[model samples]
Target: MSYEADVCIVGAGPGGALLGYLLAKKGLSVILLEQNAELGKAFRGEHLNEEGEAVLKSHNLFEAIEAHGLLRMEKLEYFNNGQLFKTIVADPTVGHLGIHVPQAHLLKVILDKTHQFPHFTCMLNTKVTQLATDESGRYVGVVASKDGISIEIASQLIIGADGRYSTIRKQSHIDMAKRKHGFDLLWAKIPAPKGWEPAIKMALIGDKQLSLFAQTNGFIQIGWNIEQGSFSELRKQAFTPFIQQLTKAFPDLTEIVVQHIQSWRDFVLLDVFSSHCDSWGTEGLVLLGDAVHTMTPTGAFGLNSALKDADCLASLLSKETIAQFDVQVFQQMREPDINEVLTKQIEKEQTFAANFLETAS
Candidate 1:
């Protein structure tokens, strides 16, 4: 079977969903595809920096998500050797240090709004298998599978927003130049302690790193950096002491971590890798978000960058410049900004301990 639309976006993530909403709002026919049946995911970066907030507000999508429930971190505290040393309170003018909105809520709100436009369609449980190209070998759309049945979706433009491991990008043979951060992440979430104030916490864990993010759902998200590819060996060495180290830094979390995180299985491992595509667009196909450049979660830039890309790409598409689509226009506009953020993230990861100690002193 075959379907057609003005724009076919693979992956109903933040980027794809928002782009779909934007194009559909402008009366363009769009189809957003999601391999997952549900919007909720266990491990998505939920941090909403000021830039992402501004994008949502600009699109008039912020209030609805905020009303749904979001957590505004009141402070960003730094601790050294298990001792609180500095606190940066959220400034009203600059916006809270950061806000936490579940990916589920953001995507849901965006899709709900998109549905109001008759031209927008979201296909859940559909996975793109390959790209559909014309005789001239120019890109057109995708060939996907739904419930074990083949379905072809042709569009004027095909966008790869499928995420860091983007299928569309892989199918298109885009070269993603990858950079390793030399570290991995272990993430775990448990219920917030009683009367726990909402804040972001950073702690130095015996020369390593630990961070805690307060979530709107009454959970405290805990993330710690480990040496790259060390999970197996570390788990075999007894995970209790490592977790104890975390609890030791934040005594308040002693009982909570003990109760909720007992084994290595309790923590999800995130391999830290960042990449940028050699080229972002070709003919009728373009890429956005992690599909174009994968950002590590260091400075909370991943989500916001994706949002920015979608916003800019929507504008480019609205002008219907595919025939004259020059990847340079989008790259020239976005690369510098993304480079700045990525540089900051790198600096933060490298000198975080020194900066924390210096600031504390």
Candidate 2:
């Protein structure tokens, strides 16, 4: 093997970067690939749930994120047509009000930290062309491309953290169950009001409608749900009017649409998933993050779910030399939690989207 590593991880997203960092920390050689020329700058879940916080703390990345400015939630307000119905006060005992940090910035820090390790190698502008395995069908390495040259990188194991639309998952021959629900979330970053802070806000419309607002780095995340087919028309409209309509729908967010919304693409997220693979392991190859399971964006556990995969994968790989880790154990241990949380997110988003569709009809 010209270039051999302990683990070859695909994707440089949060899950991949965080996982790479942990693998390197364990004194294992790891190589990570990001197909994009640069990090993604799209609007994603900026809020971190309590479960996610545990993963960061375990990896000693909590303080690094907290220092970037974390806004604690004092309360999560639910409203109906602007009238407050109920409130869930932040319970510090139960990890109420997790950290608020943008995905791009958070992943950047993780990438930078991973590079600090001698055994970690992260390649940007590289795409995985083919995943190679030995004659016995045990996973080995990959065939990737950079600058139009096909380069082969061998590894003791291969990890797929490539996310929902993963090419690696397809190449791995994992029998995945994919369910395309009827709803999709519209994700966007709305600027806070002139004097308001960015916290968690759940505004419910009286016509059986629901909308979400969470804050990160002083910006509120707005996710509106709609039928899966509505995005094409929605994308053609200007964002300001859409946001203005959204502000009108909920009084909790009056004048909060000041977040420099010059275009609609800035607030677009047309995806819904209730998907999982039959297994996450195949000899020296394993699937992690959205590559293995799809999560709905409920209370900010999307990226963290992937990070947890990284954590467990590192643990499994570490024990491989001393004892052959049963990858099936890892799969069984993680699938339930991932599926449970993923179902919650999908259901919530679907409920909201259903209401919106009802109103629109």
Task: Please tell me which predicted candidate would have the highest lDDT against the true structure.
Answer: 1
Count clashing pairs, candidate 1.
0
Instruction: Please write out the lDDT profile of model 2 over residues 15-115, one tens digit for every residue.
Output: 88887887787788889988887786655566677777888888777788777657666677665445555666878696566667677767867877876
Ten residues in a row with the worst lDDT in model 2? 352-361
Expressed as tens digits, the lDDT of each residue in 1-361 for candidate 1 is: 9999988999888989999999898778999999998876759898999999999999999999998889898999887666788889988897698999999899889888976788788988999988988999889889999877899998988999999999988898889999999889999999998888789999887566799999987899998998888888998987788788888889888888899999999999999998887689787888889998999989789999999999998888764665566767888889989888888889888897784667443
TM-score of the candidate numbered 1?
A: 0.97
- Please give each candidate's TM-score: 0.97, 0.86
- Candidate 2 is scored at a TM of 0.86
lDDT against the true structure, each candidate? 0.87, 0.72
User: Which candidate has the highest TM-score of all?
Assistant: 1
RMSD of each: 1.6, 3.8
Alpha carbon lDDT of residue 182, candidate 1?
Answer: 85
lDDT of 2 at 3: 74
> Model 1: which ten-residue window has the lowest total lDDT?
318-327
